[model samples]
Target chain A: MFKGKFVDNLPKIYGLYTGGFLLFFLAMMVAEKNGVSAKMIGILFLTFTIAIYALIGVLSRTMNVSEYYVSGREVPTVFNGMATAADWMSGASFVAMAGGIYYGGYTYMAFLVGWTGGYVLVSTLLAPYLRKFGCYTVPDFIGTRYGGNFARFCAVLVLVLASFTYVTAQINATGTIASRALGIPFGTGVWVGLISILLCSMLGGMRAVTWTQVAQYIVLIIAYLLPIFWISWRGDFGLFPHFTLGHEVARIVELEAQYGLVKNSAEAIKAAGVPAGLAYINVPHAAAPEGAMAAWKFISLAICMMVGTASLPHILMRYFTTPNVTSARRSVAWSLFFIFLLYFSAPMLATLSKIQLMDPNLKTSIIGKPIDQVMAIEWVKNWISVKQAFIADFNKDGILQLNEWFMRGDVVVLATPEVAGLPYVVSGLVAAGGMAAAMSTADGLILAMANALSHDVYYKMVDPKADVRKRLLVARLLLIVIGVAAAYIAAMRLTSILGAVAWAFDFAMSGLFFPLVLGVWWKRATKEGAIAGMLAGLISGTWYLIYVGPAFMAKTPWLGIDHLRFGIIGATVSLVAMVVVSLATKEPDAATQKMVDDIRIPSGKTVISHR
Target chain B: MATSKHEAHWNDTKGLMRITLALWFFFSIVIFMFGYQLNSVKVPLLGYPLSYYMCAQGSLAAFVILIFWSSGKQQEIDMKHGVSDAERTED
Candidate 1:
């Protein structure tokens, strides 16, 4: 029998959530106006928002295996889509995506296109069939479909590697946001993020995360939109942010070119008196290469990101929570729409922030001014004092030249409201949104890695007949262990946030995407083929990255592909290996073909029995 | 007769899928291959560059429409061939 919809009484839940958030927002506003210090206000905002998420996690906690693993497969369509959207849009998408565009110009649009295009592949190639298969985890699908423990174990290894990288980046973003908001050291922020992430995921498993993600979507969307809406409405763009922002982007490009030319000239470099290597600080905005080989890097990046999007285990795991195949298919559309709202606005916000940065007021003359005088301007002084953004005054000309300024891209969105002279509360709200984005993603990643370990590796391989109670307990313990490990790595700051995310996506795409696709669509695909292909992809992808990643970042391309996108080559190898090996070996048996046929149907019936 | 007919219908649906996926490949790849070139050309009325618009909003809209289209069409194909789950429930 079908279960009753959880959101059927959505009105009550909606009223409570909306009313509670409003009450909290008003309290913060009042407290700030009553002369609460900015640091205290920010701490209150971050603490309150994360606390609400934790409370939601506790309320939705469950011990039942079915509920813990996949939320009992009862989440309705609309809510599932919202949860999926929140899971898909990690801290990187919410906080750093626009900042990427701000820093890298047109080349960075690859993230938007590649990430969004990924959902199309998901709905078409993966979701419905996976839903019909009624598996609890990605590795469940792999193990059952391939009819071997080796394939399942391979999936677990790939899932852990990919999701761990992703979760670390989210934890790192959390650290940065929490540090800025609470005025604490970065190390402490990582611990705070780790505790909060474990709290949301360890107690209830997927059941807790599903509803908390819905709550997070609300917080993140509101927080993301408010400042953009403010900036758009205040600026000449009127109410719609994306409407007139094309012109703003064009203007930003123009200014970049002007500054770029000036920075590159001998006179300007001599005026700055910096080292020759450091003379060119402004990267040209329109550096899309015309050469075929160079352009291949862009194409490779786009493809890797797209395939990686569909390959992510945490994302695929969310589709398993939907009620039926029909709903699973519909849910992908909903996820796309919800994600579009933020992604569409990100570029517009990026352009607007750039315009504000280049405004006459903020770009004050520091030339000929003493160091103290140069540091007096509020934005300049704050950034320079913290060394977050710097002004070297290399010429000691006392005037701030464009080439003399350097600001990190990650600060663009966080500093936008400040640059626009918005109220201090807006910055606090942005910080909360950033936290929600990072925490929501962290919750999903930790849960996926835990489920893979407990279900695929431990339950299936180690203790095949373990009771649900034992399995669930093991899962919760694994969640806590993984959370601490990822947090420890995040605190070390081994890689930049965006760079780490790129690695995670590329690894998943290379190792998992093709195998999963071929496993479903190709009847000729054998168990040996799947296993060999996966191992080949993972080893080749990681090896290439380790060997050539740094040089690729320095603008040297390996075989016309950036090191970040070497996954494309790895995926090609995977595809070819699967086909060649599957042909060399015998086809999958008739029963396996029958299983594939059974899964391809949109029937509500579960063909496979409970593990 | 009925089983063989079902086999024929499944094959036909598979054919339709190939066509649809080909279109998706074109949009995801061919469009991206020319992304820079496309971006250089602006849409007159929209005042947005083609590549920028496509990456930002156009492809998303296409994806939403494509999923619904494929899902709906696949359902119709199943129903017409007496292969839908609803047919089983009726039995």
Candidate 2:
């Protein structure tokens, strides 16, 4: 029954994807040899992305609703895992997360916890249950489960709020990558990202998005892992042998003795240059606080991450495309397994790079001038020509001072290849991967947004009798409009990739996590209760994040009491509100109770029947 | 016949859910405690800070182990409940 005209386009789709991938690789190779500026490489990458989208257009006709949403439920679990991984990774994971580890120390492990922890919630709680309900959107789950249109409406509002905010951050990352790598204006880079997202999303719908995301995941993972492998190899070999030995460790101690204090402070040494023989293991004064307070914030952030992973709208929707509940569970296990392969390597990469920045000899070689002449030198000229500019002199003291640039966590992933003196081709691949991560996630969120707008809101809620074809058209239109809106918002605000992405987690944990979890687990949970919980979560979470979060809690706090703690607090309030309200209000009728019962147990009856 | 089959299926699902939930809760606590302990204490291993090592590397390895252990337990529960997909296919 699900098979349709679009399914026949598979061969042509394969051809287009392969051709585009090859062409991009070839173009990048040529650019690298010609000594193209980083800016030119970025422009060429954007052009290549556009060409790929055009190729997708040639293979498939204009998308209808079914094709654009859920890929008509035709995706295999393994392939879906790849697509979901791309969705899950995003530009933040691809580019900024490693940098976060570099600057934040082990504290940044919270990101991994948040991302991977969410899958556990999805697999055990949401994915299989939602699939059983046979719904296309999250609101569909709400509407069907509660037997009321209002619940669906609230679900749609929450989905849009979370997803649009999330997509804006991704677009922001794309703009940053393009401007820094290609030398284009941030606005143009954003446009480039927007055009790529629109073309990939609007043309084939979920089918195009699914395949493109799969390709993007491959590019992003390879781009992320290759540099780490190269750096590790170089470190192990004589190229950077001190990195492997305890030489840097010994030198750090020696420098402490000579300078009277550990000279690892980036700000203090910025103008003076890194003293010779001790560039590694320099802990800045700002970061060197000891005790429970440090541990408390780190642990709190990790809890937020663990809970937030499950609540993300784009990540949860991928489960709907799976063939069965069991498959959905399996896919999640695989996703986490794949995610770990890269997640573990991130800290290692950060540590290695930090060591390189601190190494005294590398600093001196790249610093170029004596300490006295260093003040007259411009920062850009010193490292632009040097092979290891990321580790070069910042203070002009002929010593390398690792301060401002090193503090920016986003550079860890971008600078890895250059840090190890790998080829420019590696950088190009990383760029492509970064683009892929952003596009894959953006496509998923845009698809969910379009579905919520067209399917749940306009059709089911507003006009139940609307023609299917017209509904499909509206869905397509909504995809384009939402994509453009996200691009516009991204262009205006949401500066850092990690910061913007983290805000989405905080929002989702606060708003949806309680409603979704309570709605699924507790039978007594009434519509009024659900609504109350959701509103409390949304208003409180948003307020704390916008007002209290930045003011009071900069990071995760101890004893469940930071900005991130608000999500748990909001979630707890939601649960209590739901229970209290449910008991206070009239119970749902027998039919609603039976519906809840059906989802709770697996009937021995076959999920599918022949005859 | 349909009623009997349905009842059996319901029983199997109940059993599986109970097992899965138990395992999930147990693991969640175990992993969380391990992470907490790692953060609170400092026992060095292999020239690196012990607590730092566990939070970064140890917890992840433990998680992978948990997945495998849970999968095995799931297989056992499926068998005991006569709900294994292979068994159903044979029927």
Highest TM-score among the candidates is held by which one?
1
* A1-611 per-residue lDDT for model 2 (tens digits): 23555435545654566566666777777878888775567667656655665455445444455455666566666677777888888888877776666555555665665566556656666775665555777777776666578777877887888787788988887776766566678888887778778777776767777777766766677677767777767665234321242333334334434433333455655554533322222342112235556555655566667677777777877876665555555667767676766676666666666556444555422222344443333432433333223343444455533332223355557655765676667777788778878878888888888988888899887887887678877888898888888888888864555656676776777767767776667767788878777777878777666554665445544364665456766666766777788789888877776666555443233222211
Q: Which pairs of residues collide in model 1?
A: A366-A398, A366-A399, A366-A400, A367-A398, A367-A399, A367-A400, A368-A397, A368-A398, A368-A399, A369-A398
User: Which candidate's lDDT is highest?
Assistant: 1
Point out where model 2 deviates above 4 Å: A1-42, A57-65, A237-292, A361-398, A401-407, A551-560, A601-611, B1-48, B64-91
Residue-wise C-alpha lDDT for candidate 1, range A1-611, written one tens digit per residue: 22465557654685688778878878888888899887887898899888988998898889798889988887877888889888888898888887787766667777777888788788878887788887889989989988789999998999999999899999998998998888889999999898988888778899999988988888899888889998777665666877766666666566666555344456654664443222223544433545565456666777888899999999998988876777787788888888888988887787777777564433433433456765776766776566566666656666656666666666678778876777778888888888989999999999999999999899989998999889999999999999999999999988877788888888998789978988777777888888878888898888777767874435455686766787887788878887788789887888898888777666537656675
RMSD of 1: 3.8
TM-score of each: 0.92, 0.81
Estimate candidate 2's alpha-carbon lDDT, on a 0 to 1 scale: 0.63
Output DockQ, candidate 1.
Answer: 0.39
Q: What is candidate 1's CA lDDT for residue A263?
A: 43
Where does candidate 2 chain B have its weakest 10-residue lDDT segment? B82-91
